[model samples]
Target: MLEVENLDLHYGQSRILYEVSFQAPKGQITTLIGNNGVGKTSTLKAIAGRHPASAGTITVDGTLVRLTTAFQAANAGIAYVPQGREVFPMMTVEENLETGFACLPKTDHHIPDHIYDLFPVLRDMKARRGGDLSGGQQ
Candidate 1:
């Protein structure tokens, strides 16, 4: 499970989130629904470590996680797919996936079959350049 407790965030002096909190259980899809400028994206940014939370605790599976950088969030098994689909244009789809191995030891670097199972098209387009795929594929 992923938990955000008493999350507070700010952009300069304007407060984006005030004591926001939520829990996302494992193996389930959780979504944030709200009108524009209601801090939905801000809250996601805080959880994804794209922005710092002024005060709060983020925990994954009962372990507290420090969200200081994108890499830190990845280390905590948090994955964030940007809305703009920011994939390396020159790299193949498989190559992009392999980039995540940067934070892992060499022995654990290979992509597992489960990943391909979850998104079979990725397996078929593994050799295709990221920029060549449609937005949904990316």
Candidate 2:
């Protein structure tokens, strides 16, 4: 469960968001749609702590977090896959996936089998260079 209320964000003196609010619960797909430069990505960046909110609050699992950094958000179970795939080109497929472990505890470092199920080709090409993969594959 997640909730964002009365969020405001800015870049220097340029304001990007104003009183933005939304909610998402487990087992549902909530989408944020808008025209270009309407603060969709800005709102997400605020929620994920990629961008700081000038005002307002974000609550996840009933805990209020004033997002100020990506590390804080990741520690609160907020995972963000940005619009552009920023996979490590030099790392193997397996190694790239292993990077996700940074957000998890040691007890959960292993890759989930279901992830492989979703991207079966990744399992087969685990040893290959990530840079060589097709854009779509990455």
Candidate 3:
């Protein structure tokens, strides 16, 4: 499970989140719903370690996570997929997949079988440029 408690964030001096807290249990999808500028993206960014939180605690599977950098977060199985789907437009599908290994040690830097097993369609597009995929495919 992912647990975020008493989360706080700021952009310079302006606070964007105030004591935001939530838990996403294992094997379920959690959606954040709010109008624009309501801190929804900020909250996700903090949890994904894309942005630092001024205060709060984040735990994945009962282990406390240090959100100082994206590497730490990704190593801890946290990733941020933006709404716009920021895939490298020119990179081949396989090359783009390798980008996620940026945070992992070289020895552990390979995609697992279940990834292809689950998204079997991707196996056929290994040579396709990331930008060529449809929104859902991407």
Candidate number with the higher TM-score (1 or 2): 2
lDDT per residue as tens, model 1, 1-138: 999999999999999898998999988999989998999888888889899989989899999887778878888888887757899999999999998887688999899999999999999999999999998888
Which residue segments of model 2 deviate by more than 4 Å? 68-71
TM match of model 2 to true structure: 0.85
Q: Cα RMSD to native, each candidate?
A: 2.5, 2.0, 2.4
- Model 1 bad stretches (over 4 Å): 25-29
Report every candidate's CA lDDT.
0.90, 0.89, 0.89
Clashing pairs in 2: none
Across 1-138, the per-residue lDDT of candidate 2 in tens digits comes to: 999999999999999899998899988999999999999988999889898899998999999987666667889988887988888999999998887777677999999999989999998999887898999899
What's each prediction's TM-score? Answer: 0.79, 0.85, 0.79
lDDT of 1 at 86: 90
- Mind giving the per-residue lDDT tens digits that candidate 3 earns over 11-112? 999999999999999999998899999999899889888889999999999999867777777778887878688899999999998987888788988998
CA lDDT, candidate 3, residue 17: 96
Task: State the lDDT at 77 in candidate 1.
Answer: 86
